[model samples]
Target: MQALYDVPAPAKLNLFLHVIGKRPDGYHLLESIFALIDWADTLHFERRGDGLLQRHDSEGANLPPDDLCLRAARALQQASGCGFGADIHIDKRLPAGAGMGGGSSDAASTLLALNRLWGLDWSLQKLKELGLSLGADVPFFLGGTHAFVEGIGEILHPVTLPEQRFAVVKPAASIATKEIFSSSLLAMSKSVAIVAGFPAHNSSENKTVDVTRYLDGFGKNDLQKAAEAASDDVVQALELLETKFGNSRMTGSGSAVFARVVQENGKSDPAMATMLQEAIPAGWQGRICRSLEHHPLKGWARD
Candidate 1:
């Protein structure tokens, strides 16, 4: 294929996050359940025979000098010694610094697309190893399923979650991941055996486990406190969602918060979704998103 159009890079919600410990390299080891959501950014790729990578923002938004997409392309090119290159265009739907894994997802999709576009035929494991060099969350997007993530987000255990909906809101302001991690408010959470009960390791076993009760009460985003300390927008977003939905928590690092949209008799309530969307402030962004079973680009690369 000479070009791949309208590839999706979906955002994720950390159903719950806990900082378990710190690595010698200053990276925080974390445990979280990352759920792919329908909210996403769209990307397009066109092949280049001259082996020169380029990126374009479809919305004409300013992007970083060396964005993750370009980095991923370059990495793949170098690793495979492929003479082909790509011109990547991003739709820029997801917000930056919202802890939604937008950049990571974009990078992962670039890897998947270029792998096929350039005819490299690299295995999924090889792509994942390269993806980890770009960011911890990149591998999860490449994994293509809702997962129980650990070890700074590289280790993944795919799980099956019941279909659910969420009301997600992002404030006008953004919080730096560094700022949240550096805050004095950040603390290591006590280790728990949440993974022991999971059937993710065995494909033959039934993977559909109900963890709604755990999400509702047992787990919490450990980064929320630190993020709130760094940005008041985080606090406001949480309060706004909590007041509307009765329970809310900050996802990932912060500036975005979400609450589970309670289903009534196995169906989502449209009125609740409309009310939540209307309640968001003018400068902020909010969406009622349904969880995704797998990434749209799941089988792009060989397993």
Candidate 2:
């Protein structure tokens, strides 16, 4: 009631992303599984009864005037008409613009944490609705576990996933998400709305049935080509990962690439985590992450 501590907004890896089609409104139709990762951003919240929302980095300095965390707080305050406010302090771990959904996750975590701290007690449905307004990826974070995301990420189907380990790397270069969405490759690849894999049942509602089989399907990130073209750092990182891990792919619309750390027995290789951190380029960031079965803040709202 007074403060919330150690609340986490975990990063996500889009196990695979496909730009299957585009909508009439220009939003691309998408299919991907967003798996929560152990890498996370942590936040602490304390009550500020004067109804003024402020966000600070953990070092006690205010964050940028328009950081998503602050925006989320303002949005939630407006949505709930709550007469209370909070002082938000974030311990940011996820890198910006790495396609790891850091900003969106922070916004979603703000919605979830404040829903309780403010006692608005909004249902997950309400929280997700607010989340969608903040960013497309926010709903997937609110979905509580690994999810089959569709309809530009607003639609989510929670799915079970086998425990897995990933070695994720963020290149020294930055690739804007807007550029990836508008890249020439996507323009050439866009087509009439057809879900080639299962066209007949690809409608959003129908696709929610089950994703177990699709998870095992040979999936690839649609935006990787564009990412590689946009940054030499991305290309170098991907090449290194592929050489070391035998396979690698970009996550989301990325400058970040990831590969499963697999052993000869097909289980995840534990030693690779530390080795990767040392092997990655001098300025590049790398970490080994385990996929989460559920969001750390899963119980914050009703299912």
Candidate 3:
């Protein structure tokens, strides 16, 4: 039996999400930078000779019968005419409905891993097209870099982002994307601007500069208002983070909130996330996350 062990699917944060307009079909036009973070979900795969796709959870009993991992495998199988199937086991770390793009990342990882495992050697562009059919966020995960995303997520341009530490909080609440997108309270944000030394364009060739202050006033999450209204847990989580970190924003129509950790008293500390955790409710989960320059699988495929 052939297998891949301990493969990772990293999570992402939306530095800022701005809704510029709406499509004729009612999908929203967006301008946002998706940043990869160190937080990730791990997956293990073993090839099955019987052409049967199966899944299991190492942690015992959390995954559903039908999930994106299964769908992704099936999609790739149908696309490349591969006759082999595999057993996919996921060790889920990122929470669901947290707006951290966990499921999409898992799905993308499945496609990439299987493409290699099955020896199809599909190009990144071909995989991305398959990913898009799976989900809008899937392409961004496939792209494997911080990106300037637009056009309801079909368009992507790699962007250089500053490295900074962020504290994330996910209250005991699940936010449904469909519910938030359909809300009447959702509104469009005008535009986004960077402060200090950051470059204005989203390109790989562009110079990289510190964006510590760029995120301070970057822009508002267009869905924040609607998310807060939909989930009182989200409202409380943001309020708690804001009280300690000065400003807090929800990531990707989620109940999860995040704030930058700044130096205090002329000294920088790595344990500040612990301090931030002390301020939040014990029932909520908190962690310090560092932004990644690119996704772990960035080199796996070509665009």
Candidate 4:
């Protein structure tokens, strides 16, 4: 009897991921600035008068039936006692296991949208608390702001990132973050840097770090060399992006590599985006996305 709404589950690119230490529970302590991109998977929520949560999809047949999206809806229902249900449809665009946080974003969006659609009217802090139980990255998406994240990513300091365009390429394989973190070759004992401008080629900065200064400075992925060593295709793709765009880095423990590029052509330069897409390897996927200082859900927040 209620209207259906389409919610976006945007993909994230970890500007840099630094594994500082391993927790006793095996979750690694990480420091990274997670940036949301324009590319996203979308979820549609249609309230069911019958109180049934149904999911139909045009893109993601591979995800298991008991997915986080449904779980999130159930979580909201139990948390709010809204006495409402919905049919959720997913239009998945981002690749799975590519470290883009596609599923987690979907779960976050589902919780946020349903909180509104079901008339629960929960606060952002409450939504983020619920989202954290779903996934590490889910809290960040629920916060709907760019953040300097720490403590296995529960701690967040909202940040304003400069508007920049990115060219992202995903190799044909997925690198598990857990596997990479547990690898002996992964850099663990490296001293954290007190970065004034940007991450020290591969370090994390505190909340006081200036956002503009960091943008001009190049950040590095500490797990990249290790992940690339596990997959030669990742190494090859990184090389292609760097050779073409000059500022390329792997996002998270990644098969996805992204490059910063200028959209406009001045001084007789080829559009970096146009060049990268045309040169994408035969077995790889690529897209151009503009960085966002805020997530779409910011508009929906109860404030």
Candidate 5:
């Protein structure tokens, strides 16, 4: 095929993030569950025989000149020694600096799409290895399912989570990942017995698991305190969601916080969206997002 259209690159929510320790290399060791959400960015790819990698963004998007999509495509080309090229267009939807892994997801999608567009037919493992070079979270996106992530975000253990909805909010302000991690307020948690507490359930199974039993009082984003201190908007977003939903937590790092939407009679509360729309302040973004069992492009690459 010469072109691939309407390929999706979904965002992720850090159901819970903990800073266990710091690696000698200055990377923080983390343990968290990265849950895919339906909120996504769309990408289109057209094969280019002229051996040139290009990226186009939606009008008024004003993306960075050297965004992850271009970086991912170049990296793949160099790694595979492929002479082919592609023109990638991004329909940007996810917010930046929301701690939602938007850019990483885009990069992962680019790699997966280019692999097919170029007919490289690379294995999933190969793509993931190349993906890690792009960013820590890129590998998780390539993993293609909700996963229990560890070890600076490279390790992935696919876990089954019951279908659920979340109320997600992103404030007008943004916080840098480095700023959150470098803050003195950042706290580290004692390494817990993740293997013992985290149940190992296959994502392929149709059975339901009571995720709340483990997540109810589980770990939190250790970076939230630092982020709140950095941006008053973070504090506002957290309070806004917590006040309305009865509980809220910052995902990944900061600026975006989410709360689990309680279902009524086995159906999502219809009023959740209205509540979010009214409660969130002007210039902020909110959505009622459903958890995904797997990424939309799952299995795009050979296993």
Candidate 6:
């Protein structure tokens, strides 16, 4: 009997990303609060009796033949030595290279869904070991919770943040992560500290050093300066968003900027989401998404 498996690969917002330092290996130490969004790409997997991995979606057609999805499936198969293979399908909704963690999320979904479909029954720790090989952000998506991430983005600790609204805008252009990281203009120095008692502790100290406050005070994305310097379209799009939303900042490396705009009551705002979506510039894509406290399909994983 072939069991059908479907899972969601949710996009993420780097509520804010700070490059604290660069490592000898060229990987940058980062401090970021990553929140999952409602917008997600769906992946479906079907087990094949024969031991051969296959993909059935066109979302990543133009990506290199050896994309993360295929690589993930192959890696899982190799590790488990499962006699069965999977035919994978992806419905890509998130934009590519917008710093939304699309590819990494897809890879994490592949590892998780296939584990159950093949009856691998691997523990979360084991799953993470395999997932990290796919990408730094893969483990966070696999962990399936809002997180405070650090150390080249592999170390993840769940953090409680108030449910919030974000107006996300992706420029027509895609800024390559590698280019931004390697750019000479990137800011590579920042101090490290745990953002304790985020939105819940609205005390004067908390208010002074809260994630939103830190972001508003710092006005930094190590990659943003480099990315904007590298492309004019990105700068134009970011400028327009900042003009509309006063608290606007780039989400990840480049090309996608987000504005934090929760309601007066500190609740999610559907109207704001609608307005943000409608207000996208002629050549850009935008959405108003709520920060997800938990992954939508977490119940499915229990099956």
Q: How high is the lDDT of residue 201 in model 5?
A: 27
lDDT order, best first, reads 5, 1, 3, 2, 4, 6
Q: What's the true lDDT of residue 163 in model 4?
A: 88
Q: What is the lDDT of residue 198 in candidate 2?
A: 36
Candidate 3 segments exceeding 4 Å error: 191-213, 265-270
TM-score winner: 5
CA deviation > 4 Å runs, candidate 1: 194-196, 199-213, 264-273
Note the clash tally of each candidate: 0, 0, 0, 0, 0, 0
lDDT of 1 by residue, 252-294 (tens): 9978899888865554556766777688778888888999989
Overlapping backbone residue pairs in candidate 4 total: 0
Tens digits of per-residue lDDT for model 6, 6-117: 7888999887677887789888888777889987888989998998888777645456567898899999999988899888887878888789898899888888888888
10 residues in a row with least lDDT, candidate 6: 200-209
Per-residue alpha-carbon lDDT of candidate 3 for residues 1-303, written as tens digits (9 for 90 to 100): 245645899988888888878889988878787889998999898887788899988675377788898999999999888988898888888888899999899999998888878888899989999999998999999887787677777677677777867788999889789899899988787544343443343333433344445566677789989999998999998888788778788899897888876766753445676676687776788888888878888767654
- The count of backbone overlaps in candidate 1 is 0
| Cα lDDT, all candidates | 0.85, 0.80, 0.81, 0.79, 0.86, 0.76
Q: Kindly indicate the candidate among 1 and 3 with the higher TM-score.
A: 1
Write down the TM-score for model 2.
Answer: 0.89
The CA lDDT at 139 in model 3 is 91
In terms of lDDT, model 6 sits at 0.76
User: Per-residue alpha-carbon lDDT of model 5 for 42-91, expressed as tens digits?
Assistant: 99998898889988889866789999999999999999999888888889
Off by over 4 Å in 6: 58-63, 194-219, 264-274, 297-303
TM-scores of the candidates in the order shown? 0.92, 0.89, 0.89, 0.89, 0.92, 0.86
Residues 1-303 of candidate 4: C-alpha lDDT, one tens digit per residue: 247899888989988777777778888888788889998988999987778888898754577898989989998888887778998888888887788888888999998889888878788878888988888888888878777777788777666778878889998888887788767778753433466543442233435445666665445677887888889978888888778777778887888988877644462223555666688867677887888768988867575
